[model samples]
Target: MPITRWIRGAKLSFARLPIRGGAPSEPAYIYRDPWKGDAEQGARIVSGRFLFERQEYSFPSGRWDQGTWPEPAQEWLHSFCWLRDLRALGSDEARLTARALVSHWLSYPPTDLLVKNASVTGARLAAWIANHEFALASADRRIQQKFMERLLQEGRTIAAFLPLPAQGWKGLKALKGLLAVALAIPEQTGFMSRFLRYLPAEIERLILADGMVAERSPEAQFQAARELTEMSIMFRTAHSSVPPILETSLDKVCPVLRAMRHGDGALAVFNGSRELYSSVIDEVLAQGARQKLLAPSMSQGLFTRLALGKALLIMDNGPPAAEGFDKRAHAGTLSFEFSYQRHRLFVNCGSAEVGAWNKALRASPAHTVLVADGLSSSDFNAEGRVVRRPAHVMCEHQTDGTAHWLETSHDGYYPPLGLKWTRNLYLGGEGEDLRGQEIVEGERATPFALRFHIHPDVTVIRDDEDIILKVGGMVWRFRQKGGQINLENDIYVARGRVEKTQQIVVESIQYKISSEDNKLQESDEASSKDSLSENKEKKKFSQTVTWLLERIPE
Candidate 1:
């Protein structure tokens, strides 16, 4: 390890040592958690067990061991985040159970990598401090002192070891904890200065100027926006002006977040993002400093938003993020999500929370995009970084009285397969007709598949070569020309759970081109022509898929 890292780690280790002298007193400030917790969940925690999807897992004798806890509840247990749920109950029983949990953990803190995680520790600090007003108001002064000591220790650990253990937007979580510690103990001038010194730079680095998160996930953007909002509260507690960078970062993030939402008001699932709670999303946005200046444009943030009448479309229009930031990046270049009014008519299979599904959901087929040779546009290596990504992604948008049009292409497949994929989308004046063309062009015809995942609520009915979709009283017809069509079972991970869903897939029809046509040159403009050639051969029927969706009257 580098000398700097070694020194930092040494300092962190010392910070974790039990104090030999008098314990610290309660922190000066009472940090608010900002987001509400579920009282029902809090009741479950107080019951000494967790209820998940109607299943119960009683806490084991060894509650502090990572392996002892149910896999689904490990992070929540370790970070003590459920304290918020307990506090939400705001009853004597809830308080006693919470105190017991904290008291037990203080005597036997988690002794595993999960508890050692930077983000986990950051969250632990934030949670422990946020609810200190109630969770630590015990008559037992020893418990109160221990709580303050733990907060200071965790905050010091974050300040010393950040950017080393913290990656992508996870760093924002750590920064929030550090700032919380800073505000809680403004008497510690050095600790406060440390946060102020590093905050602006970290904010600028993790969040792009256009407001997209460095991780390139709209879901991560929500996390950043929410954490910053909470930290804005922390800054205010300092009795000082809120940092300008914090407000500006919110300005940049909130708008992209708004544009990334569908008609249901939930975030678009892109780059390993799930549809976070729309209510929490609304609350966070409301807390943000209103943009005094014009907010950043969605296009500048590598997203294109189309809105007219009741139709809303959000498309990912950029290449994967840079190295360190691309760990959770998905092969979703040119993919999109579409909704009409409050119903999601077309959607991407969102990122899963755990297991192999997390990695599988990051592949191109998970998104509403064309996958060449059944492979992702971007490729992830073992470490989760996007090892190969689109080198060039070009996007153009045009809006006229007749339609809102978008054309986009990416070269992510070029490195492995020597191909490029272009997508064209048009939503009509009345927002009823949505037409799209998916084309794969390269040195020669390439076999590809276009997968369109539907929202679980949308009922899909097969009609030979055509498909009909129904959402509540709204109905739409889906038709395709060229290639074979099939329906496949799938899953949509959203709102913190998975639901059974189906997808419409169009597979290319392979055919050997004449020698003269085998080497047809590839150009974005050529693939995006206003009209396809009348001649089947000239149109490259084997490499194109055209589909349309028009609202059908009830």
Candidate 2:
């Protein structure tokens, strides 16, 4: 929030650093012209013209007192605008900005640092390292020295920054990679080599077995990937191969990355990040392509090309990855993300915007499941407290050509109510229709709940036989034999400004079971007795409803 305020009022500009003029250089193999134009064209415009243009600063100074200057505000304003301007102008201007920015950044001492400020600084420094092959190859020695020194200072700050033990793993990995690059810099070899030795253990602890980062949010995963990819590029440019673990880690991660993408080029924004960066995925994919690594196909819109060579299926078998140092992971477990033929299905609820009011909005019901009792998993509370350990069990899953089946029997939810829920999902083989069943296996009959956060354009209708969902004129029906309820007409869950009212509906039905009797008269009595028992059971747990849903159509 403070950073957001700082960004609004800052004066930032970039001037293109001179490139030794010659025959125009051939574009690098990995380089694709950005949407606006090649980086150079944009750079020239910003450096020669835009830098002189004045603009109003909406960012706050956070300087309540007159004596002390808002150092963080200044650093953020310059760094944020510098990065934006670099992208607009080209790597030449970016290099120039990086050089000047680093020099200014290093002039300050480490004790006066802000965590977010350091994080962004690391990202920009890493970006410079990535583009070094093209932009910095013929740079001035003074600029290079200043760049290296600034990067080292960032590394030290990151290393010293107190990160929460559980979630800081990804940030730590990123910090380590950045530091490794700084160490590889000619002047910082001794210090960096010693720093680099500790990275392997750190990476092993942070990265999960399935290539998912410790913090499971797609946004965090993407950010970590961007940072890692940049570091790897820098290492390769320095003539050093990447660490073997990173190479192996990325292989497992690519599918999940692919799975998290929607049919649109945008990622399924979940957790706390919704601001789409310019060509973030494109840069990563370009790097991956040049390295001969298989990357996901991504497009910007409905009719854009959908890369299908890489198909992925992701299941949330555990609670959100531990939020060690990062606060972006969500609380949804037993959920899934699937991508095939350029179509994505069943994504985590996209992220909320960052700031104060948006804090509770992050826990919006539409973003996740709100069972009749509580959350789907008990690993963490809304305040992010780890109340219970995640249950360990074999989650049986099988996928055939037509449908996928998932069965999770975990004790994680049993402690609160002596209840065990085995959730089974049958997704149509073609990935169109889905049917789910939650069997409560416990001494007492408990309420079973399922919530669906529909996309904005979706339309929902509750019918006697089924619940029908219409998206873009396509109708999909979910049929239930017993009875149906519409909770949207009943409950109110706090969704943000996007929807005036978030609708949630609940439905229930009853079934009758009877057996043939030896005689007709005896059969009548047996039926009556069975009816009495059923009535008593229903009365005992009248609150146990069958259906609860929160939906948004595509």
> What are the lDDT scores of the predictions, listed in order?
0.77, 0.45
The numbered model that scores best in lDDT is: 1
What TM-score does prediction 1 earn?
Answer: 0.89
Please give, for residues 1-554, the per-residue lDDT of candidate 1 as tens digits. 69987887688787777664433587777767778988998998888887553356665445477454445467656667788898889999998888878877877776566545767777777888888777777639877777777777777777766554437777777777777777777776667687778777778778776887877788888888888888887767657798887887888888877877777778888887877778988898888748533333665568887877888888889988888888778888898888999889778887754568778888898889888888888888987788888889999999886678888888888888778778989999578889998877775567888888999999999988888899979889888987799999988876567789899988888644444454443332366453323233363323667899999887
Candidate 2 lDDT tens digits, 1-554: 58744542231111112223321232122221122224543354344322211222232223212213234334434333344445555555565654444444445323333333435444444444544544545656765555555444445444443231344434544464345445344454543554456556656665566555556555665656655565565556556677775666566555555545555545654544442443666666565433433333211100011122333444445554443533554445554444443333333345443333334434424343435354445444555544563465336656655555666645555676555555565555345545566555443445545555444444656666456666544555554433344535222111223433223333334322222212343434556777756544432222222332212244
Give the TM-scores of the predictions, in the order they appear.
0.89, 0.63
Residue 132, candidate 2: alpha-carbon lDDT: 50
How well does candidate 2 match the true structure in TM-score terms? 0.63
